[model samples]
Target: MAEGLFRFAAADLDDVEVSSAGIAAYGGDRVSPETLQILNERGVGLEGFRSRMVDEGIIQQATHIFCMTRSHLETLEALYPQACEKLYLVCEFAEIDGEVGRDVPDPIGGGRGAYEQVAACLDQAIAGIIGFLRGTGKGQAG
Candidate 1:
């Protein structure tokens, strides 16, 4: 969801490469129906997205790595301590002041309402991410 939202938010910026993966994912897994439906309702197409696991190669290549929860950050930190400097909580990097904390609650295993809430949070964070990327020149003007 965050990947799709970031892609949608950065649609105008051609130079950025935005993607997301799960720490425990198996390659080629489809996104959850809840995620698909929510993004679809928002007019963000995640059609070719297949779940992939975060590997050393992916981590090494990423200029920035945003985790949805502190646990995710810790897992990555444990696996690749050398890359810890670039790892950050999504909310922290988004700099959403007064956000319920750095963690974006996992909406998995819930119903539509849970998905909706997660989507709203993603929308807010994605907007802030776009702004931060642009200000830093990491995302070039189209």
Candidate 2:
């Protein structure tokens, strides 16, 4: 969801590489139907996405790593301490007031309404992400 949202938000920008991975994912698994449906409704394509577990190479290549939950960040930190400096929770970077960077709740196995709520949260966080990227001069704000 973050990858799609970031891509949609950064469509007009250049030289930005946005990707997503899981800390403990089953490789080759397709995205959840609920998520696919929600993204389709929002016009974010997910036609060929496959699940991938995070690896050392991915960690080394990423300039900024946004985790959906604090537990993910903790796991990555414990497994790849070298990449800790660049890791962050998406909500934390978004500076969600009074929220203490809560995990973007996973709506897996839930209905469309749950997916909708997750999408709304991702939309808000993605806006802040774009702003942060632009403020850092990594890409232009469009």
| Candidate 2 C-alpha lDDT tens digits along 42-101 | 899987988898898888888888889999999999999998878877876564545747
lDDT of each: 0.79, 0.79
Model 2 regions more than 4 Å off: 95-100, 139-142
Give the C-alpha miss distance for residue 83 in model 1, angstroms.
Answer: 0.9
Q: Judge candidate 2 at residue 97 and give its lDDT.
A: 42
Model 1: colliding residue pairs: none
In order of appearance, the predictions have TM-scores of 0.88, 0.90
lDDT of 1 at 4: 86
- Looking at candidate 2, the ten consecutive residues that score lowest on lDDT are 133-142
